[model samples]
Target: MMQLFRHLRLGMKIGGGFTLILLLTAGVAVIGVRGLTSIGTTVTLTTETNRMAHEALSARAQEKDALLRGEAQTITQTQQHITAIGQQATTTKEKIADPTINEQLGAVVAAAGDYAKVFQQATEVRQQQTAAEEKMAQAAETLVKMAQAIRESQYQLLAEIQEKTQVAIQANRANVDDVSQIIQGIMQLRLTEEQFRLQRDAQTQAQVDSRHAAVVQLARNLQARLQTARNSVGTQVNDGMEDDAGLDIHTLAEQIIDLLETHHAGFTLYATELTEQLQAETEMAKQARLLEEQAERIRADQQQEFAALQQLQHTRPEVRNATLANVQATEQFIRGVLTVRLQEQRFVQGADAQA
Candidate 1:
């Protein structure tokens, strides 16, 4: 068997199969890692951008508030000034009632009148500022709406990308398992019927039976995983986060498995063509054992990875179903405004027709 394995070209079909499996797995692992990296990077970038945008908006609001406060202060000062001037004017008018004090009182009243005019002009300027402030607030609100729309779009996009990435990772995991199983099965085919019969008879060996049972269990588990994944995906696509990570993993495992089954069928067909070439060879049982060993190793590795993935999934927080009450309220308000506007427009048309 060892000799047969030695004759097995490192570039032979068996070796090539192993290499392909490794390459596929590596490619998927790299992609998965990159996707995770991207998720983190994107989240950070969006958070920073949102923070900056909100900060800028808040600053503008604060500036507007300050301007309004300053205008208020100015209006208050002007009113006080006008009140003082009026008081001064009243005193002067009282003094002017005496003909002797009339000339001095006239000058005093004239100066008070000028002060009052200045205060009036200041008040007008303050009113204009208040109007300008209102316009700015409206503009800011419009900008906020646009930003919110953009953010919502991005949120939807983010959710979609996350789902796609999860699917990809799941598919990759399944492919790796399939490749491992296929390699094991193909290698096992080299065994002589007598040798297989011997192993079957010796199935009393707990370890051998255990391994056999494991393979069968794995297949069943894969099917169950697929079903769970389908269900989880259905829910995930709806509106909220999915709590069941296993479902997703199972779904991905199924894709690889289905592909493997297809490949295995093709391989079985090809094996028919190679039967003559294989039967001519002796010590094929040794080659079978080597292949089985390789398969076992691959299985071990896969199980480890699967376990780790499961652990990670288990650690994930359950999806929260928090309600955005504010958004709901705003939607209601918008509907009300639209209804009122429609009614007002109809009333205006009716009045115009009557006129």
Candidate 2:
């Protein structure tokens, strides 16, 4: 029991010694690790705080520079504005004091106003002048048309008169040829004096009877035609009076009557001679054709030649002259009026331009 107790005490001493050694080593290792961790954390926190401080300083410096530049720019802009205001004031003073410049400006303003008014008046006057010119031109054109119409009407009237005159002349020519042929036939028959007397008496009586009937009929026909011509002439004169704005229709009518009178006697004589000649020609042709048909053909040929001679009389100068004179007179009157109107228009235009 004594040995066991001692052994236990020694074992306890040994175990306590080992436990103390282990506790000492473990406490030293824990303190060393904690010291290292605290040192590393302190160094890292210091570096981060230093970097943040440097950034704050740089930001403050940049803010100061921006504020300085903004102040300088504001000062320069204000100075420039003040200088510009001074220049404007100086220029205003100079303009207000210069008499010649002020006068010139006033003159320019007045001139502009006057020019506007003058331009308006000029435009109005030009329009009026143009309208007047157009009206004058239209009037002149109307005159020209009237003149042309008058000329044509006069020409037609003269041509108709000339045709009538030519017809009278042709009839006279036919009568003369027929009378000559009748005389020639009588002479060529070679009848004895007694036979000639007896044949002449019979022929004269027959011719007298035929001539009386033909003359009565011709007189009746001529009277009717004369009445118709008179009615037509009266109607034409009235129409001419209405149509001719400036012509003397009474004088024209008198001239027409004179022309008719000039051909009247010749026309009557021609008809009488033509009738006698035709009667003699028929007798001669019958007498000659009783023996031969060839003689009848020859007589017919002579009649045709006489008819052709009458047609040629229509080409006389008197007929053409009458037509030309009437047309020229009417044309001259129209042209003269138109020319005068044109001249008046030109004069008015010139006056307008001067005004």
Candidate 3:
């Protein structure tokens, strides 16, 4: 093989060498193109992940704001935000090259979903609580009115009893002082009963019971004193007039108390429900925050990946530049070699590598 190569003519050897260099240059170009292509793909993935992650973060923020408003009217808006976040997560997942980032993004999607469900439930419960509170307020107003009516009825009864007792006093003027004092006590007792009606639950139920008992006792005393006076003086105490008023007042008072108690019980129960909803909302908010934080972490990861890709993108150009320089140098060297070969061929006429 050495003897045959040595016997070749100069022109033939030059042609063979040029052909080999050409093939080598072509191979290098192919390799460079393949490397640049891979770099371009990494850059694309990084850019897509960055864009999707930004969108997801924005959507998550909007969802949080909607939840903060705590208004049922915003539920649809909140749902839309969550949906947008989910879509972003899906898109980002596709674009993310790193398995760790992809998995974390999936967790963000799941947490967002959980938050969405609980947030909707909380809003619905809040609406229910609002409605229940309105009803309770209305009932409370009605109870106040009913209690007022009972007070007025009691006043009317006291007036009638006093008037009946006064007739006996004038007829038996000797006992006028004693009867006058009793009438005065009856008026004072009616005033005290008014206090009971006005009393609130700031005091315990026992206090309320005590006041209620006192009112009953005072009413009874007034009725008894009036009856004794009527029996002694033979004064016609129209039994039906006082009986009907007292009975009506008692019945109405009981109803007012019942309503007030019902309102309180309803308030406690509804408030408890509202409290539970609030706690649930708080928990969901925390999960949403965690999801948001995780999305941010993913975004950060994407940014880091993008930085690395940018560096790789820079290296690709450098590699291309280096390859171009090598090709240019090789071309210049080949041209010099061809010029030398031409001179030699002209000077040593008809000489070739084949001998």
Candidate 4:
């Protein structure tokens, strides 16, 4: 080998050796560059995916907050509307001094109060709904974490699968089980949600079946046992049973139940009447508010027309003729004001006229 190498030119040998070294170095460089590029691409893809997930989560949170805030704002607006209606009703009552309007206004105030209570109740329910949504979201997020863990386990399984070793096979089997378990948990959540969707009647039936049946039987047995005890204790005191002396316990209980039921019925009837009156008042309030809004709009339009007319007169030459449009608008504005004022006068005079 030394003799063969010695036969070659010294410069040729050096150049060939250097060229081989350079080719090997270039090959290594290409492989390193490719490895680095692959790593960088993977990192970028993972970062983009994480960013997308974060953005999606943020969007969901924002949507939830927007809904909650929107409802709260709506409730506040409704409250303000109710308060304004109440104040206007009161003022109208005092100014007109109409017994009917006063009565109607009182009914409106009461109805508004009831409506406010219902509104508060509804708001509380919304809060509960929000809480339920949050809980569901948290559950979904937890499940997502489980999915991520499952994915990691799957990767491990795949890596180990290639080794074809016992440990690898066992790990793959465990990963499969883990995946199944996660799927089962997801299914369980779905089932639980489905259960929650059951109707109230069906839920009541289930409760009766599970608990009430046992309770009923127990009560019957208890009553029978108690009767026996009383019979034994009474027998020792007397040889015979009393026909119906002071066994007024049942009768008294029945009478008490009857009294309560009567009271409840009376109260319910009164409440129903109140609700109807309030509903009528609410309608009246709505009508009054609409009329007032219309009147205000008319006034605003008239004011604008008046301002325009004034501006026109000031800007025009003293000898300039009034436009047909200006003359018509001015007449319409005066008629509108008189029409509104007449309506107010008629309402204010109504009680006295009726009397």
Query: Whose lDDT is greatest here?
Result: 3
TM values, all candidates: 0.22, 0.22, 0.47, 0.32
Structure candidate 1, residue pairs in collision: 1-286, 229-247
**TM match of model 2 to true structure:** 0.22
- Per-residue CA lDDT of model 1 for 1-355, tens digit only, reads 2334334432232222222222222222222322323444323322322232222222212322222355565455534543443354345345223342334334433433443443344344445544543543343344234323323433443445564667645543553454355335323332321232233233323343343344445545645654655566685452222222222333333443443344334333333322322332222223323434543453455445444544454354220100122122223323432343344345436645654
lDDT of 4 by residue, 260-279 (tens): 23433432343333343334
- Per-model clash counts, in order, read 2, 0, 7, 0
lDDT of 3 at 238: 46
Q: Candidate 4: deviation at residue 292, Å?
A: 23
Return the lDDT, model 3, position 327.
Answer: 39
- Looking at candidate 2, the ten consecutive residues that score lowest on lDDT are 17-26
Once superposed on the true structure, which residue ranges of model 2 sit more than 4 Å away at CA? 1-100, 163-355
Q: How large is the C-alpha RMSD of every model relative to the true structure?
A: 42.5, 64.4, 30.7, 39.3
Error of 1 at 171 (Å): 25
For model 3, what is the error of residue 24's alpha carbon versus the real structure, in angstroms, after optimal superposition?
A: 47
Compared with the true structure, what per-residue lDDT tens digits does model 3 show for residues 1-355?
3355344433232222222222222222222323333545444433433333333333333433444356544667657655655566677567655555556556546544544554455456556666776776676567556545544544545554565666543433322233344334334433443343233223433453454444444444434554565566453644322346354433453455465456556655564664564454344344433433443443344345334545554656653443344334334433433443344344334322322
Model 1 scores what on Cα lDDT?
Answer: 0.36
Name the TM-score of candidate 4. 0.32
CA shift at 59, candidate 1, in angstroms?
Answer: 34
